[model samples]
Every structure is written in C-alpha cells, then in structure tokens.
Target: MIVFFLAIAILITIKIIWVLCATSGQGSFDREKKEIIRRANYLTSMVCTSPQGLLDEMPSGIGEQFQGEWALYTCSMTSAALANIAILYPPNKELSIKFIDQIIDIAMSEEIREYDKLRWREDPMDGIYGNLSHISYYSHLAWMISRYKQIGGDGKYDDLYHSLCKAMNRRIRKSKSLNLPTYPGEYIYIPDMLVAIVALANYSSQYEGKYSTTVDMWVERAKKEWIDKETGLVASFLEAYNDSVQIVLPVKGSYSALNCYYLSLVDSEFAKEQYDCLMKNYKQGFPFAGLKEYHDRTCLFGMDIDAGPIIFNLSPSGTAFTIGCAASLDDMEFRNKLLKTAEIGGSTVTWFGKSHYLLANLALVGEAIVLAMRTSAPQTRMRNK
Candidate 1:
C-alpha cells in the first residue's frame, strides 16, 4: 500500500516537471503552428503515400466497425490542422493548400469511403446526391472543403461543395427533428450533426442565408430538447426512431467539447454557454488537469472507445478536445494547462524535423486530433448576436 501511494506521488511529480520544462512553449501561436506544421508534414506524407498503411497503425481497440470511419476522421483532422495553420500563419498558406488538396484526393477516394458505403449500402457521394444519409462521412468532407476555401484555395471543389450544401440543407428540412444520423440507423449523435450544421452555417454566411433557416431551427430545437436541463451540456446522442427523439447519453464531455468546438465556428455566444457548462461540470484535477468523460464525477465509468482511457477521472478524448474548445473560446489559461497535460501524458517527441506524440503515434487519429485542437482559433460568428 505504501509503495503504491509512493509510486502515484512520483508519477505526479514527474508529470509536473514535464509540463513546466518540456512543453513550456506550448499554446503560443508560433509554437503551436510550428508543431502542427511538423505533424502535418508527417501525416500528409503518410496519408498521401499510403492511407491504407496508415490505417494499419490504428488502435484496434476502437473496433473494426469504426476502423474506416476513423481513417476518414484522421485525414479530416489532419486537413483541419493544416487549414487552421494556413489561416493563422499566412506564410504557410500555399503549402497548406497543396497539402489539403492531396489529402482531399485521398479522403474522397472510394477506399476511404468504404466504411460508410458498407454501413449505408451506397457510396457516400451518391448518398449525398440521393438522401445525405451518411452524415459522418459527408459532413466531414464538407467541413474539409469549407476549410480549404477559407485557407485561400481556389474554388477547385466548388461543384462538390455546392452539392453537399444542397443535400445537407434538404436533409435537415426533411428530418422531423431537423437533425440527421451518423449512420443509416436511428442513432443521431448530436456532435456529428453539429459539424454538418456548422458547415451549412458557413455556406449560408457566404451565400446570402441559403440555409440560415435550417441552421436556426436546428439551434432552437437543440437548445430546447438536446441540452441537459440540469447539466446544461449538450446530450451526446439521440434516438430519432419513429419520428420521436430521445436522449441516449446525457452530457458527456467527449462529445460536448467537440460540439462546442464546432459550434464556436458559427455560434460563439451559444458555444460560450455550453463551453462554460462543460468546464464547470466536467473539468477535473489540478496542476495535471483534464475533463472527465462522464457528468457524474463520482461514478467509475472506466473506459470507452470515444472517451478513450479514463484515469483518475480525466478522459483522454474529453481532455484533448477541450483544448479545442478552450482555444476557440480564448480561454488561454485552460488551453495552456491542458496543453501541458497533453505533453506530459502524450510523451511528445520531435525527430527528423517532424513532431508527434510518441504515445499517440501508436494511433494516428489521436495525433491528428491533437494537432487540430491545438491549432484551432476563434472564428467570427455567423449569426447576429
């Protein structure tokens, strides 16, 4: 018993040292941008070279069903990281555009869309032409294209972008609840839908309110039904079966932070509301801090695929993504602290002009997400206050 306690104390002390010394420059725009560029260099090369080979390194624990979904997500995150850096650091825009184009080619390939195809029983792009059923795949694709444009890319993808925007708007208009599913089933994860909503909102802002009504209606419905009354954080998932909506998971940090990050892009005020609720309720620990996976802190919900590993009440996904929310919300203190925690826990390493978390390199998606979150910046809200 004494040895176990001593071990814990030692580990905490070491973590503190790592935070203070090793990652002292984390969270700064230059530092974060330089780091993201390194990882982007690595990920872009890997993704453009052998996307399938990159998938081979994915953590098998996330399950086979999600393997392809994660592959798509990894490229999406890598592209987002590049796009953010391009905007935040102008000198890199040309290179970032090139990298984004390469990633898009792979992301839109049949190989990457196979997972969604298998589940929804149709090509994701074709589904977009038909019903927009695969929200996860197509929404992310739309988001990447949106970012590509924001970073000064030529309108090379305008046709595909317009098709996605029209399809998403149509899907939202037709849905009884103004939300769509990640898959073909009744399950509607609000975070995924929020990504699509943000994409639509982005399109609307540039196109004279084309989907503004759809975006506003979804926001109104979410505020009314999707947020947990007690916690104020958005519900994680809803079942839209039989034209009725039911919350399946209530106020999870992993999804809430992700939702807030996406929401900040289009609705800063409401995003701030949910962001405050998330920090107040889910954030745990001290000098080595992170957000909890569950709302009820006392419960021992050990681990899950989305939340990753839960340790001493801190969740990996929750903590990592909260960095994004903090970045978008301009909570520098919180963002830097989490950045420190990430360095300590992630075993960050820089080698051969490339930077990546040594531990996270085991799973490319984790590294991709960290790059995306760390580089994310606040955006102008699409709606008038």
Candidate 2:
C-alpha cells in the first residue's frame, strides 16, 4: 500500500510539472501543434466510426430528439475545434480541413437535422432566405464554414454561408429585441445569438461590410439590454414577446463566459470588459481555479446538461469556455492557471498517439471543446481580416 501510494504521488507531481512546462509559452507551439493533431485524429476516427453515437450510457428516459441535439453538438463542436487546429498549425491544414468537412457534413445531414425538422416540420435549410429560428444550428454551421474559408478551404459552401448570414441578419434586423430564437418559438439564448453575430461579422469582413451594419447594431443594443447589472455579465435566457424582452435565467456563468468568447471574435474591447467582469464576479480560486455556475457562491446550483456538473461551486462549462476567452484576450496568466486546473481535473490519457479525457462521459465532446478553447489565439481570425 505504501509503495502504491508513493507511485501515485510521483505520477501526480510529474503531471503538475508537465502542465507547468506546457503552459510556459516558450517553445510550446510545436508541442501544442502535435497535441492538436493527436486529439483531432481521435475525434476524426470516433466520429467516422459512429457519427451519431450517443454517450456510452445515456439514460433510457432521454428521447431521440435530445439524442439528436447532443449528436449535433458533438459534430459541430468537433468540426470547429479541428478548424481551429487547421488555422493554428498550418501543416495540419489539409487533413484538418478534410476532417472538418466530413464532420460538418454529418452535422448538416438529415440524421442530425431530424430534431429540427421534427420541431418545425421542415428542413432547416429549406427556409434559408426566411426567418429560420434555428440559430444554434445555423450559427455553428456558418461559423464552421467561416473558419473553413479562413484556412483556404475550397468555396463549395460559399452560397450556403452567404444564405445563412443573410437569413440571420434579416431576422435580427426585423426583431424588436434584436435577437432570434434558438428554436422556432423558444426564447433566445444570448450565446447562440452572439454566435450568429460572429458568423455575420466574419462574413462581413470577407465581403464588403454587407452585414456589418446589422452586426454592429445588435452589439450596440445588446450592450445596453443584454447585460445583467447585478453580475454585469450577459444573461443566459431571455424571452421576446409582446414587443418586450423578459429576462428568464439571469447571471449564468456558463453562458456569460461563452458569450465573451464569441464576442472576442468581433469586438475585443467589449469582450475584454465582460471577461474582466466574469473574472471579478465568478472566478473561484480554491477546489480548482474555475468559474462558479452562478454569481452567488452561497446559492446552490446543481448539474444541468448545458452547464455540466457543478461541484464545490465550480462549473465545468464555465471553466472550460473561459479557457478560450482568456486565450482570445491574451490573458496568459489566467489561461495558464485554467489549463493547469483542467490538467489536474480532466483525467487526460494519451494512448496510441491519441488523447482523450477518461473522466468525461462525453469524452469526444469534452476533448473537442478543450482543443478549440485552448487554441483560441487571436490569429485565428485577425490574420484572415
């Protein structure tokens, strides 16, 4: 027993040292590039094996619609992560682009879109020129294509990209609250709407500022109406009806962190302000340095699918998404600390030249989010412009 304990201690110490060295930002780019390739390869193989597989042991109570949504998230997030890897490490560009294309095609397929189609009774792409309220689906699709274009992929999806941007922009421009529903009649998730804006911003930059005015107006208006004064972070859910906006769930750290990360793509100054506010209000030091799910530490907020499991006042999604925000804003110290925390908690294992999180039930999804977030450098978008 003593010998086993000592061996475990030695391994833990070695891991801590490894994390420190990796985050030192000196000659780490090569290491990161290699790591991205490994993770990307794992994701590519897993998705290729079963593009729409659910978690290993999902609850029997969950229906097919939720299962489809989960699969869609896995596909889109993985593709986006691979796209980032393609941009950050030029050598992996061709293979990464191929992987992204494959995953994104799955995301757009009928198997993935069945849930949206079931809800709306039509194909998601059918209303490309109309108010298709599937913001999450279309925004992720558009963002993936934008990233694909950034890395010199062929223009096969150029028309789809333009139509998505035009549709989202038209909806936002005509809305009273300057936001669109994530679903047909559901409330607006600020993070999802921000993604639509980011997609439009990227599209506008590529073109000649065609949707620039719409993106600019939404950002200006959101700064006034979307911010929660108490936490000074973006509200997670809001309902727009009867020509008025009602805040549903306020001060969600997970959504706020995600919104800031998306905002960094277009508005650095505004994103920085929200990032600072998030650090001040939601950042926690003990029991793993991460963001709390809710602003009030004393308040008990439990696990949810969106925020993941919250343990000891720490939120998994909030912490993971903040990694991307920190990298985007160039906050290296905090980024390194978060990276250290993830290394300590994620139970990462590298085998056969591929890496994954043993602790994550949705291991591929977690790996995808982390790879995309950890590689969130400014050059991903800045150079393209």
Candidate 3:
C-alpha cells in the first residue's frame, strides 16, 4: 500500500512540474507551432508599429554596456525577422513597408539616428560602418531592403539599397583581416565572419560577380587555422589576420548551432560539414526533446555575452536559434524537436491580440529565429504575386 501510494504521489508531482514548465494550449510542446507563429508576430509587431522604436525601449535587464550597443545587434535580428515576414507570410503591406523603410533609414546613415530618449552606442566608428566594415552594419539592412523591395514592387529604396551595398564592398576592399576585428582592436568573432560572408554573397548575386572566390579563401583559411586539431570545429575567437585560435569554443552547442546556420547561407558544403561535426559531438538527447548546446567539461568555462544562462551548458538562446537553422537546412525533425524544447522552456502569454513570451522569455533573437523557422519552410513563404 505504501508503494502504491508513493507511485501516485510521484506521478502527481511529475504532472505538476510539467504544467509549470510547459507552455499553454494543453500546455504541450509539439503542437505549439501556431503559438510560435503568434509569438514571432508579437516580436515583429514591436518593430512594425514603430520601426526604429525598439531603440526607445532599451535598458531592459541586460548590462548597460550591452544595452548601449543594442541597436547594432538588434538591427540584424530585426531585418532577418521582418524581411521573412513581409516576403513569406500574408502581406501586411502597411506594417512590413514601414518596418523595411525604417531599416533603410538606419542603413543609409553614418550612424543610426538619435531617437528622443535612446542610448545608442556612440563610438567613433558608430557611423554606417559600425564596429568594423566587414562586419558591416549596413549589409543586413541592405539585404532586408533588397528582399522586401523585390517582394513589394517599390523602387523607392533602390538607391539606398545600392549605396549600402557599396558601403559594404568599400569596407571589404579596404579591410586587412579580409574580415575586420569585431571590436575595433579586439579579436574577430566567427559568427560575424559568417554574416559578412552572407552579406557579400547576397550583394554579388544581385549584381553578378564571382564573390565566391573570396568566400572560398575565407573558408579555406578558417579550416586551415581557426579549426582546432583535436575537434574539427572552429574556435570562437580567432586572430583577424592569421586566423589563429584565440579562444577555443570547443563544441559548445549554442554557438556551433548558430555558426552552423549562418555559415550555411554562404557555403552550404562547408557549413554542412560543421553541422555534421556539431551533431555528432554536441547534440544532447533529453526525455522530452534535444538541446544543441555544449555537454562537455568546456561547459564549466563561464558563458559569453550571447550565451544566456548556461545551465548544464545548454543555453536557452542557442538552442532556440538552432530551430531556424534546422528549418533553413530542411532538417524538420531537429527543428521540431528544438521547438518542443522552446515550448517547454517558454510559456504563453497574450496581450493586445498577440502572443508574448513570458516566464523564461526567449528575447528578441530567439523570437526572430522562431519567425525564420516558420517562414523558411516553403509552405509559409509568400506566393509570388
């Protein structure tokens, strides 16, 4: 009788934990895709309603130094999220156009314009070039404009688009590291290298040139120097010129997953090799789902700015973003598994007719990844009208 009653108590305890941990709608994970879409739209709306207004609402719990540079990284997330929404989802002409135009406004300028009460970082290089040209801030804005303009049939942004592209090219041509330092004098971050490569590739495709040659060289350089001998994965930080490893990230899943995703956009074959290596080494299976973050002793080394709350070395942010990567790479199984993990981690809250993430909120970047995952699948893309 004691054993029987103990079994019942244990089952009740498990059910309660599941309820508290899981999201709404039967509080289940796998079936929460629609909720994911709604949550994504909420983040998109934060941009759509005001465009540059996100800057106004800065100073959210993160450190002051990071909050100052919020505009720089958020711009990339905003463009990637909004561009897909405008292109693939049902057209919200007014909303998408306003968002795209504001992105153009930032892209065409020397620096993001000072909003009434915002605290954007004002470093000397804060102009259109940002921290470095190769890690060009304008590149993302340009790509977003180009994609939206193609879809929206408005030549309104054409000049600005070309100008931003030229800005990126100018910076690339003058850069010494080929990829410049992520910080003015600091080391180069591999993820930024992936972004710079995509930006260049997108520009070349639109204008037609063999940009692949440069990409090929960058890939070879990384493989030859940045990759660790023990593990076939990239070191997180590398010397800009010689590509020597400054910091070995080891097989940390949060970075490897994103690094895998971004690298794929520029060089699919190489990115695939990286992705395969990451999965073989870092992908961790749980009872409910899988995580893409680190599982080794390297997990003890303390988290970086991007890796949020590294419990057991599994970052909520990294695992969340990998969902979009999986969708882009057409790995639906992994994508769904990651979504389940997200759902379990995030809770559903609605306000003003939109879903917002609360209780372990995934933040803007994670929500952006959710949008990318939904839109990247062919079925969700806006039909070319």
Candidate 1 Cα outliers beyond 4 Å, as residue runs? 1-18, 299-301, 380-385
State which candidate has the highest TM-score: 1
Displacement of the residue 105 alpha carbon in candidate 2, Å: 1.1
Q: Candidate 2's residue-wise lDDT over 1-385, tens digit each? A: 9999999999989988876654554233455666667777777777754444533222334576766666676776776777677767777789877877777677777777777778877688886766657777788889888878877788989988988888888778788888878776787888888888988998998898889998898889878887787877777889987997877865788889999998998899999999999999999998678888887755444777777778888888889999899988888677777877777777566789886666545445666677778878764454663
Per-residue accuracy of model 3 over 207-293 as CA lDDT, tens digit each: 676465666677777777677555577766666545323554554566667777777666667777877777677676654454545
lDDT of 2 at 189: 84
Which RMSD values do the candidates have, in order? Answer: 3.1, 3.2, 5.5
Whole-model Cα lDDT of every candidate shown, in order: 0.80, 0.77, 0.58
Per-candidate TM-scores read 0.91, 0.89, 0.75
| Best-matching candidate per lDDT | 1
lDDT of each residue in 306-352, candidate 1, tens digit only: 88877777888889999999888888788988888888778766778
The clash count for each model shown is 0, 0, 4
Predict model 1's lDDT versus the native.
Answer: 0.80
Candidate 2 regions with alpha-carbon error over 4 angstroms: 1-28, 53-62, 299-301, 360-363, 379-385
Worst 10 residues of 2 by lDDT: 51-60
Candidate 2, clashing residue pairs? none
